[model samples]
Target: MDVSAETLIKLYVTMQRIRLFEERVADLVSKGEITTPCHLYTGQEAVATGICASLRNDDYVFSTHRSHGHYIAKGGDLRKLMAEIYCKSTGCSKGRGGSMHITSAEKGLPGSSAIVAGTIPIAVGAALRLSAVGGDGVSVAFFGDGAVCEGAFYEALNFASLKKLPVIFVCENNLFSTHMPVEDSLANPIIYKIAEAFKLPSCRIDGNDVLKVYKTGQAAIERARKRKGPSFIECMTYRWRGHVGPNYDVDKGIRTQKELDRWMAKDPIKALEKMLIAKRFLTNGEASKIVTGIEREIDGAVAFAKKSPYPPSDEMEIIRYLFR
Candidate 1:
């Protein structure tokens, strides 16, 4: 797996940015500054960073509720994203859509939905439209393991396979959907097998390893661009934070502390750093400098969001009328 030094550095920087951003968001949520229900993408940073690195600026990405990492990795503006979470007028959605509904058409992120599996069909539709126009850009749908149980998941996969649409289905299998473990929820528990059943090219990779994810995503994207049809990529990863909050969910007794510690030990950011240092791609001092820069960027975004004002009361009514 030969990757350029520049690409590897970019991947590391992107992952760091996501980690800092999510950590800041979690702090804000704890302080009640960010009132929105934010699903922090703390430990699953590598999946988004690796996958989005393979995408062009024009390639579309449909995201799930845990969308901040996807948005940031896909080149979304940090200030606008933070402002959106703060429900300010300068937000990406003009404060209309909060954390779960961030969208940036300019960045090729059409939108994300709060409802599980809601964006699957939307991504398939977008792929169909792209196919009709003979566009070379591929569309990607980022969903979780829980969505596989939904009818929309099967339906979207079936249609994409049937039409050979240029779309990539990325399932971030974090082992749990909300509080329910995969064992309790899924009868089979293996998601990639379902994609195999659809006769689509599919593979499961270690989502924590950015290199593995990047290589696999590159292949999937290439297949889609070649019009070889949709591909399913199951990324086996874990989320460090609770299902919906900033705290660990061990208190709820759904997951054991031992289980959480085991996953935490495989922290993607540290793993990448270790690999980079080992390969002479980056020095410890250089990595520290990179992290410091990202922290400053995150701080600036937080300050920007804080200074931005909320939308006027009348503006909400006008938006409602327009949408209606």
Candidate 2:
């Protein structure tokens, strides 16, 4: 498969967008301006950006509590995203869902759940619809390694594989499940191997490497769209922030500053920028401008969110939004 200069640059831009956006979100959370509990996606930008790079607009993506990257990478509106985080009426989910629960049906991000592995079955159901309705679209489930412990994860995999449903199970294994390390919780530390039991194609790769993720994801997406069967990918990545907030977990004694620095050294945005500059696909100056543009875009989104109205407070208006 051939990779173009444009595609490579686009990958870099998307990673930068996620990284910058998440950083700003962390800052906002620190200031207490955004009241929602945010699970920032900092070091793991490449996993979401690369996987989503080759996806079609109609293909669905279900995400986890750390969902900003996936939602943005899937072409969600930044303004709506920021608004939701700000809990404004104009936000996606109508400001009710906040950071963990965001959705844009038109953009293929049907929804995300704060509960670990909550959306896995929902993604399978979407794939079931496509399989039954004869659509080419495939559904993708993005969850952390924590989900692997949940029975719903296994059930979703089995049902999808059995029915040959068009779905991709993307396990964004960021080394730790909340504060617990993967090795501490899982008997078999190798996550992708579990897919073999269900007879699905699977692999584990360096999730920090955008090109590898992009190529592998494209292959799986292609296979699923062809109606062959489901595929699984276990992405080994790191989270730079705390499990629930902007702080690195070092202060909590769960991890160390040195360990965090080592991961930061392998920062995905910096890695991609190095490659792009080496290939003459981009320059430091060009990259700075790209980051500036993204910063401006994010600034606009923040401004929009701050100015937007909060969800209506009237009892009847609140009742209108409630479901049966």
Candidate 3:
């Protein structure tokens, strides 16, 4: 697709920023700096970066537990995200919502839910509202393969189809949902086919290829914006970390090292870097500089999070609804 050099470079930078941020979060988690049960979005950066690139600042995006990449790619403030994970008062959710529940309406990320398919219906509602107001804005819901098994997933799809809501359902099918492989969990492992049952336009693409993802996402977003109704995109990607920690799950015998190595070899960040280099959009020195800049940005965000104060004990009263 005849994409401009500037766009390609931006995609590369965004993916790199996510990779660096997630890596730093992993380090902080290991050092007890972030006590939240974190889910790293290391290997799945391309999917979020490419898809969010197609969305407007006003477009709504609902995310899942693995959402740092989604939030960052959707223009969320890096410092506030770090603070949220650190449980500081200056967080986007005011320190009440940790890693799994970060939300920024200003950035168009309404919220992310830890529940498997929790945000599906929320995105549908957002899209329905947008349609009622006669706007072209689209809402996107990002979920994993595990969420497809949830009844909520089917219900959301059925409603979206019936209403012709302006929404995009993106499933980051990374082969395994937690410890179970997709093959073992589903009678028919092809996820995009489920969308076909809803009579929605759908396709699966290589999530490791940022450009491919961008092209597909652009088409889907344009379709929604034009009031063509919901489309489903199944991005074939992988998570480099375990389900809820910073370590590789291969050590637990859930996934083989060979499988992890294969996906790592197809690293989305590296793929984009190589493509940019090949297209003369960037050189080795320039790529290195970009990486350095991202590292500095991450360092600054960490410093901000560390210096931010935690919420006062009395503030617990503000969250009294949780007790009931």
128-155 per-residue lDDT for model 3 (tens digits): 9999998799999999999998999999
Q: How many angstroms is residue 162 displaced in model 2 relative to the true structure, after the best TM-score fit?
A: 0.8
How much is the lDDT of residue 120 in candidate 1?
95
Overall lDDT per candidate, in order of appearance:
0.94, 0.93, 0.93
Deviation in Å, model 3, residue 168 alpha carbon: 0.5
For model 1 the TM-score comes to: 0.98
Candidate 2 per-residue C-alpha lDDT over 14-100 given as tens digits, one digit per residue, 9 for 90 to 100: 888888998999999999998899999999998998899978888999999999999999989999999999999999988899999
For candidate 2, the 10 contiguous residues with the lowest summed lDDT are 315-324
Which residues of candidate 2, in runs, are more than 4 Å off?
none
Local error of candidate 2 at residue 297 (angstroms): 0.6
How do all models score by TM-score? 0.98, 0.98, 0.97
Kindly report which residue pairs in candidate 1 clash with one another: none
Candidate 1 local lDDT, residue 199: 97
